[model samples]
Target: MAKLPEGILGPVSGTIGSIVGAKWRGVYYIRSKGKKRKKTRSKKQLASQAKFKFLQEFLKPFRPYFIVGFQNEALYCSEWNSAFSANYKAVTGQSPDFAIDYTLVKLSSGLQPGLRDPNVRYAARNKVEMTWTFQDEPMVTYDDQITMVIYCAEMNKAQGSIGGVSRADGKFVFKLNPRIAGKELDIFIYVSSLNRKLISPTHYLGKLIYASTTKP
Candidate 1:
């Protein structure tokens, strides 16, 4: 299945027989494929695998945000993978029970200026409000967009805004999904440029208990 771009004379790609062809940093090369090995997992290896699997599933819901949130840090890897690498240790706990620490989770990373004196509150049943001021920084712009991630662990669901509000607005009113009412919500916010070329470090806004009409 190897492809010869120059009609059997140029560089090749893909796999052919026992050899695999690929390009790295512009140079084409071929290497014999290594045979797959089966090995029993040690305690340490099992813990690491557990963390990897747990984090992957936890971050799946945030895939859309990672595309722009980790764009600057992606480098040779994908945006999602870059985010996973950066947050692997920060959000994942130790062995025996590698639980995810929601407060330590980061949704974005970059050089963009973040909100000044930001605050969030469960304004009412099914409504949340966020307020912030623009910082006096050279890179700060009125057109910079605000992004938010509101997660409800009770229902294992998340919802948010992406580049839907401007930094100049100073306040945003996010209407929660009706189903999430009464659940505790963890909130995170960050700023990004319209084109997503620049992003700010994610800020954790603590948790809010969405009020419900029904009695506990």
Candidate 2:
């Protein structure tokens, strides 16, 4: 029960006599030597970092689910890489590391489904019509679910249509505020399989200037 210097008011019971314990800010704290981070990374750590960075952007459309407090970058990367390796081995019968980049693209890309040319137009009061036909998936199953990521250039933010392809005719309609007319709007299309077991690479549809105005 001896008091120590620098506000450390408790006895350290551990074998390491070099360290000291203290109670600060209503919490018990311990002081220890600090270690520096390694500049070089192992292959597995590098791979984990790569997948983590890709997932940050790839899962942007579904931020809350993949990036919740329950998960961390390092662990998440490891989990995703492990999952990818297992799936790749099952599908192509090859070492997963050999095609990590290719696999990353396949998993992150939103338009990999190879949808035909997309058409976008201003429809009536404050709605826009988007239509596109699908192309057959050559090596694997085709993706049927669609997501339209709308990048409002002026706002520097994005809004996505979760069920952009729920319509029966492969058409998507969304209402926009006329106040945003004349501003630039960028669109991206992403498709996933019905079961969502697969997601395609993203396809960039040219920028569309909102034309409808409430005043006119």
Candidate 3:
């Protein structure tokens, strides 16, 4: 075929086709966009990505805790691990590379021992004491530190977190201020381990209003 004159070619100067100039074998040539790659995805893949996106929204506030849990390798062989493996394979056509992807980390981090919420009790002196025990796997790890936080809903202010108790016992007592003693207080508890490299995840126990003891 005789070489076309150098310049824009027919029907090749827009989104579909742009007959720009090119040199080939000491000759100028016009070219158009090549066939698209034809990207495709399976229903499972779409489902997997959709699940991931949803999980990102659900776990945004808890990211710090989730990363820590993921780093500690806590999700092994759990329901989450199995579910993730299935869903991710459906999307990626293979097992996870486990390269610490952010979404994966967050999802895995949020999953821990779903221990029943600890029983919170009003103690002897405007203090809150929490008691809980794991039936199967222990929720409290050796290096874990338990912390309790209190907030007054009516005041819309956090009394703040206190009581860095050891996880070995799975129980902690935190005192409330006199000013907010009779007021209802929301309570939250989370566990943190000694590892500084990973971000910690918080597992809230429950909430309660603080009051002085009715008895010893």
Distance (Å) between predicted and true CA of 16, model 2? 12
Model 2: residues >4 Å from true position, as ranges? 1-107, 110-112, 136-143, 164-168, 177-182, 212-216
Which wins on TM-score, candidate 1 or candidate 3?
A: 1
lDDT order of candidates, top first: 1, 2, 3
- What lDDT tens digits, residue by residue, belong to model 2 across residues 118-171? 787656445667887655546234336666666554554455565436423567
Candidate 2: count the clashes. 10
Alpha carbon lDDT of each predicted model = 0.84, 0.50, 0.48
lDDT of 1 by residue, 136-172 (tens): 6788888999999998876767899998799999999
lDDT of model 1 at residue 146? 98
Top lDDT model: 1
Cα error, residue 204 of model 1, in Å, equals 0.8
What TM-score does each of the candidates earn? 0.87, 0.47, 0.41
| lDDT score at residue 208, model 1, on the 0-100 scale | 91
lDDT of 1 at 2: 84
Off by over 4 Å in 3: 1-117, 134-140, 160-163, 196-207, 210-213
Error of 1 at 116 (Å): 0.4
- Model 2 C-alpha lDDT versus the unseen true structure: 0.50
| lDDT: worst 10-residue window of model 3 | 98-107
